[model samples]
Target: MITAQTFKRGSRPRPFLMGILNVTPDSFSDGGKWDSPKTALAHALDLIEQGADIIDIGGESTRPGATPVSREEELSRLLPVLKELIPSIDVPVSVDTMKADVAEACVALGASIINDVSGLGDPDMAMTAADCGVPLVLMSSYGDPSTFRTQTIPGDGVLYAREKLAGLTEKALEAGVREEMIILDPGIGFGTSPGQATEMLAHSSDFSLGRYPVLIGPSRKRFLSHAFPGKDPDAATAEACEIAASSGADILRVHDVGRAAERF
Candidate 1:
């Protein structure tokens, strides 16, 4: 029973798996297949059966070069599914968004966590999470959603991730988010080259800013292709999960919860 309230900064006694459910038709992987609420709910249930500790629902695709959607469009796609699915699932639900409004709405609808990939790019996002009293999963990304793929590399991957995440943690705390409720993530493939992504993953244990728990999402990412070349995405993702787990990641967001959980 891993719930949003259960995870303290570094208090996770076991690795937790967050199953990803993309409700967008343009997601880089497994898009269109679960765009509808009915299908998305089914997939979420399946992930739970597969040992997922939480369900992360995303309406817009944030893949490299992905077309950005309007706030209204993102809400339209997410609210219906969330409204229908939250009550049915036993585990906590997390909304993946960079918008404060969306995060607020999802929290009102019973979502337990806000998984912001843009590192709280929206100034109001931090307030929304704090007001909701839910955990905020902040990823390390210095670019906006549109240009995240083309951001300039600062320096060494691990150091860059640490600095960026440390900055974001300050922003979150300044916005009134409690220190223990903040979780840090080194955005694995969000704005990093394949080599950089690998470097970040290898050093995920160091992403923590003081007491913040570290989360890593390297599931089926394009960066894995650099290592596996032509290996199966599932196998590669499982390997990535194992590495992340061993490197001190408290949580892992992945497409295959069963396989990822097994690595722990």
Candidate 2:
């Protein structure tokens, strides 16, 4: 399981695995497959068994152009699964939502981490994470939520990601979140142009905000879709994971736990 000690600088050379569990019907990948509480719980256990250090569960689809679900709707889809899965799993579970209310509710249900892909899209998200005292994953995504996938980096992707995360980290600190409990993600492939995303991912180590652990989610993203297209799904994902790890990513957010466990 991931704790504050797990994220200490120089503690991890190879990135730890954080499996993705999206309980939404519109996620670009594997959507509608595990939206049910029972199936989600089963998949969570399977992931843990397959060597997942953490499980990140999201109720709403953060895929580009997907409408944001209401706070209540998100909780409705996420809470029941968390209620059944938290007590059953040994590894940590992170609630992936930009809404502060959803994060709070999940934390109350014993969630160990908060992964806000919006990088504090909800004004109170930082405060909620601080109040819950859980590790917060602030992924650097630019522009409006509606344009997350199509948003273009104004300049260098690495610089943009780093600067954005740095500002968000400051906000989190001022909101009472300890610096050690903070984690950073470069939001690889969330924006436009495969080349831009590739550059951001290649220099992932440079986006380390607050000197915190960097978590890269390059698993099966569109940017990597063009690489080795006809190969097995995990083939490209494994390569991306290797790149992220080699570039100093501390956590790998991915879908295929079995393949990552085997390779990493």
Query: How close is every model to the real structure, measured as TM-score?
Result: 0.93, 0.94
Clash counts for the predictions, in order = 0, 0
The residue pairs in collision within model 1 are: none
lDDT of 1: 0.84
Summarize candidate 1's per-residue lDDT along 98-159 as a digit string, tens digits. 89998899889989899999887898999988888999998987566566567746778788
Candidate 1 TM-score to native? 0.93
| Consecutive 10-residue window with the lowest summed lDDT within model 1 | 1-10
Q: 207-264 in candidate 2: lDDT tens per residue?
A: 7754788898878777787654676668788887877777777888889988876666
Model 2 weakest lDDT span, ten residues long: 1-10
Candidate 2 clashes between residue pairs 3 or more apart in a chain or in different chains: none
The superposed Cα distance between candidate 1 and the true structure at residue 254, in angstroms, equals 0.5
